[model samples]
Target: MMRANENARGRLSWKVAHRAIPFALLLLAAAALFHFSVEVGEGDTLAWDQAFLLSLRHADDVALPLGPAWITTAMVNFTSLGGVTVLLFITLTTIGLLLISRRPVEALFLCVALVGGWLSSNTLKLWAARPRPDVVTHLVAVGDASFPSGHAMVSAATYLALAIVACRFLRAPAQKAYVFVIAGSLIGTIGLSRIYLGVHYPTDVLFGWCAGSLWTFGSWLLFRRFLPSQA
Candidate 1:
């Protein structure tokens, strides 16, 4: 009986590891594609998206005006509640989870996914170098290259990662579904806010979302394999 149990455990471990391999491969492939896209000047569709977003930013009656401030203000400040801050929070949270779970491998995987996503986003932005929308004045001034939206990319990675971690703790199918829904909604809201604030082009947001999603999903697959059955 003892030998049989050991064999069964080993088989489960192998199956998990096998499933993770594809995700790791996918991450590598995405990195390579990101590099290629950077070298080639094929992904520059930010102009129109920026224009549309700018229009929304300037609208005085787009949403309810609570005195003089709106949630959009928080979205506009990249350093405040924007991409950079959000990413930082996500990174810290992942670290905390690693510490609590005492799973160095899982923590490392999350770190790689986060950093990898950031690097990919920046590379595409610099390579594309699409100008921000000048048609409508920008709500907040930005000088960085504006191709693929950083906010979109970071939000996708952070939220998706959170969802993955949450899944490990939540056993009920309904609970897991709820967690994923919330994660997806947060990511989507952030991306749209970037567009609505006249900061990121629609295409930039779209690509960012796609790239981030791919990385997050890929990392999740790889991380799952390393986890014990209870984990």
Candidate 2:
């Protein structure tokens, strides 16, 4: 019987180890992405940033993108996806859905995460104190230190937080997939829009994506540990 129990314990340990592999791999990926992005941000004048930013605009008119007039207008609309008003709206809508689903705890945590993300991103912006891109004219009015695009950071945090909740709580896997796809599109488009409009360099958007994703995943990991079912 003692020998049998030992065998059972060994099997249990192996199962636990297997369960941890995916989590470990995810953390490793996040770390790699974040590290390279921070390095890029530190040296803003690096080749890729300037080349990518300048390539988007017309050779004759720095203010205009290479595309037609309608494309520019469309980009302007897409940029709003990362705007304060839209993020707030998305947050409020998600909070209501969570509440209605009878997951008050999840709803509360979502609220806190978004507010914290907003404050943290803004603080980082002030800390970096990097000026907006001067390679071309800005299509939209902006007056802030622009190391990391605020829209990119804020949208990533808000949308990813919502995606996490949906993935965990929703029954169907398709629902989870849909949520992530929508969130990802918004985040990607907004970040690119900042560069296209000349309000932020590519480095700013990349840094924002890295930081915002790291914060979202870190917070979700903590919450999952403390309240696994709720998270």
Candidate 3:
């Protein structure tokens, strides 16, 4: 009986440790994001941001980015994926699909996640009010504050939310993994494209990724807890 109790306790402990890992990671990510935001807001990250921007530019021509001419075109194309029109179309299409499938709850949840994330992203950018980099000419036209890349944040939240929704319908583990991998790749590429285009600082992208991910995950957790069937 004592041994049986000990085994049960061991199992409980393992379960707890497994669950704790994600929470720990989430806390760490949040802390890192907050620290970066504060530092960037104080102008502490200016030198770092400038250095990375210059590195991506041509030595003789700060206007022209490094790499072949084709790469610049490619990045502009990729960056568009995170633009307002594209994301709105994707979100509406997904929502329509969900509604057609009789998953209105999940559809609503997706809207909340994406729209709220976008608003939060915009608010943070306004609050940060960090000027766009002048160390290099922007490959793509951009306006407004630049601390947290709106493209990065929106793409991360949109893709991550969509991936979570996709995972629910997917039966195969490999398929679910594929969905998440593709989502992550898209998020990463979109963010990198912004930096490569000289419109966003590396820290801007980094903080955007962190903030967007946390917001989506938090929304997901709430959805799961309150609407388990939909989640």
TM-score of each: 0.72, 0.83, 0.87
How accurate locally, in lDDT, is each candidate? 0.70, 0.80, 0.88
> For residues 128-168, could you state the per-residue lDDT of candidate 2 as single tens digits?
78778787889999999887788888888888888888787
Clashes of each: 2, 0, 0
| Model 2 spans > 4 angstroms off | 4-34, 41-45, 226-231
Estimate candidate 1's alpha-carbon lDDT, on a 0 to 1 scale. Answer: 0.70
RMSD of each: 6.1, 3.0, 3.0
Candidate 3 TM-score to native: 0.87
What lDDT does candidate 2 reach at residue 75? Answer: 86
The CA lDDT at 182 in model 3 is 97
Q: Which candidate do you rate higher for TM-score, 1 or 3? A: 3
lDDT per residue (tens digit) for residues 137-184 in model 1? 455667787767787886787678777776877789999999999878
Ranking by lDDT: 3, 2, 1
On the 0 to 100 scale, the lDDT of residue 89 in model 2 is: 90
TM-score comparison, 1 vs 2, better candidate: 2
